[model samples]
Target: MVSLTSPAEAERRPYGPRHRWVVLAVGVGAQGSFAAMFSGIPVTGITMRADYHLSTGALGLVLSCLGLGVAASDIVWGLLTDRYGDRRVLLTGLTATGALLALMAAAVTPGDGAGVVLLAICLAIAGALGGSVNGASGRAIMTWFAEGERGLAMSIRQTAIPAGGAVGVALLPWLAQASGFRAVYAVPAALCLAAAAATWRWLHEPAPAATATASATASATASTTATASAGATAGAKEAAPDATAGASPDIRQKSPLRRWDVWRLALAGGLLTVPQFAVLSFTAIFLHDVKGEGAALASVTVLIAQIGGGAARIWTGRRTDRGGDRRTYLRGIGALAGIVMAAAAVLTDAPTPLTVAALALGGLLANSWHGVAYTEIAAMSGPARAGTALGLLGTALFAVGFLTPLLIPVVIAHASWTAVWAIAAAACLLAIPLAPAAIRAR
Candidate 1:
């Protein structure tokens, strides 16, 4: 009979170079999926006006519904990933979301209200499916990488969201220009399906330890590292140690809700999202309606925000990894951006170019905190509970997400776009003072 070995030996077995690519692909695919999920924002008003003849308020509800779905699924998917391995959950999700997007393309015809409802349902489905990508990818990276490099690696993975959004905003509009929204969904859908298939075929779990069968000739002392190395699979019988034993000294088990740091980060994250989402939800419309810019120009402006946001995430992530008070840095950025957003709100009627520039700068600074927040979450939760921590954080953020888009239209109807941005700025500012307390707790 064959003997089983320790888990410690198993982790030492390194993958081939090709396997590294598989890991990277999973990270990128996860980020890109989220990017595609949010692509609906820019085109929402245009679609509503063109098809179903809905008012801005109605379209806002639909947009908010999408966020509701994402928020609703965050906890479910996070727990699922923790129970099941990240690979299976992530692959299944990508496939299901892609199918829903394709279904959306087929269901919604131009100017069809029934189609609009169906499309909203499809969007909700896709958002739920997309929820798994972030937590799963974060956990996967934690599992695969050593402690030293996790920050840079995770930041790169996180970069996919903004990069994918940039791609969607930049490319989807052009695709719609040539064809239509129906055709537009095809691109992201196809990408998701292809990535899903690739993940399933290529991904492998951490290998099991080598086994050592007892033989009459074998001696315990003789079974040294060199001896085990010479004999094929001789070390399989050794049981693995806990992966976390040597990583950090401060490993503690705490309830997610009990952790003040988690709540602070989540709240701060949610507040920061207000201004970002406001701009994302309304930038295109503001450009089209207020600035009298064409669809192409509006698309460009959205793309700029996405690209800038994406790059900022990576840069801040690396910076946090290097050494700084992540909470302080994040809070400072949030506060500063809030001030800028408040200024932008007041200057909304300024020259078109100046207004766009202000929005872009505000978006960049506001979103720059993502990598820092994500990195801190992973650190705070430790590797084992990373999924849960990320899930909880996402749930809180998306809960706030559910309100921002719809709130924008209501604010715009009664007040002005300036009022909406001002309120969002205030929301960001609310988090500034709380951040210091959070850092102390951490």
Candidate 2:
């Protein structure tokens, strides 16, 4: 019931409530641009293999390089975001990523005599740069939004992955078929540049006094109330530390890198991503090669799944914002995703319509949990360390992302597509136990 915003500080504030929405928009653009590159590129996998004369494993390796780069650089970027702030990190990373993509378009072509190794190197570098987007954008959302609406805000930002992927899957394969892979790279390059320009034009930090007062009030309210609102409870738990150290300083003062709860959340998120990445990286291959579906249909299925996933994320975010328990919701999602993926694995040889339905459902369920998990992570670590916490989680997710593609081919070679889906289902089920339990109201 205590008010954090003083009348004087409210009068001094430059941005209005609408400005946070603008910041969210900019974050979506920055994140979606990179998502288009990583998630969308795989839609061109079949064409890429044929054009480059690549083996399936080789194609997997090339795709995995992007994940490798992102995983390697995410923590470092998080550290930099904490130190240097979001605007600088987003602008530098987006511009550099766009330029790298442009270079790839110009030089790393089938006709230009470039090999897979060169292509892999370019993708890795682009991924490393693009890795800056996640932590920086996420930290911005945590800073700008109050605890009550943070779930919805973070979920909206997280939807950019599927939204960008939808764009990529819809456009890239067609471009690859009509204009060649050069055009494929060129499109995302332009997007990155555009996103960079937008970031520069908008995306400023909130007033420090507003943030400080909110923290102090939330911390005080948390200590006094036996049963507070979800927003206040979360705020109290994650609020910034006071200047004077008490017998036990707030957990916010501890580095996210060293925290067990942060690690659990990161590991749970990484495990959950297995099925999502499986769908993202190989559903086209599964549908076309295994089910005898047309390439166009396969691409359309992926596009639909992405759009559906994006919608699910938004709904879940809003639902959680209305006082639903985030950790419980996350576990429920994991269970449903596992069930869906397991069904897909079991029905691998069913009729085409049924098979497609299973795969689509699996993708939808797998993609739905990201926003909730990310919101929980940021809330646990507090806004001050959000970048580092998010970066650690990104590293885990991308490391799995990198490994998923590379391992899928090996699984397919020895076993079958059923085995791959089954493993993915298992990973999803495993994640439920690892999701960090909700913090009790102290």
Instruction: Report the number of the highest-TM-score candidate.
Output: 2
Model 2 lDDT at residue 433: 89
lDDT of 1 by residue, 1-442 (tens): 0112233543565654335446867778766866765764455456555555667777777777667777889877777777776777778778887887787677664633354466667667777887777787777766665333455567778778777877777777667656776777778888788777766655445442211111111223333422445321222121111122123434436645567767778877888888777777678778888888877666666667778877877777655444344666778888888998998898899998888887877876766777677766766776677778778777877777778987888889899989987998898899887663432211
Candidate 2 local lDDT, 135-166, one digit each (tens):
99999998877665677889999999999988
- On the 0 to 100 scale, the lDDT of residue 353 in model 1 is 83
Q: Lowest summed lDDT over 10 consecutive residues: which window, candidate 2?
A: 238-247
The per-model lDDT (C-alpha) reads 0.68, 0.83
Which stretches in model 1 have alpha-carbon errors above 4 Å? 1-21, 111-115, 207-251, 436-442
Query: Candidate 2 overall Cα lDDT vs. reference?
Result: 0.83
> What local lDDT score does residue 276 receive in model 2, on the 0 to 100 scale?
83
Q: How displaced is residue 45 in candidate 1, in Å?
A: 2.8
lDDT for 328 in candidate 2 is: 78
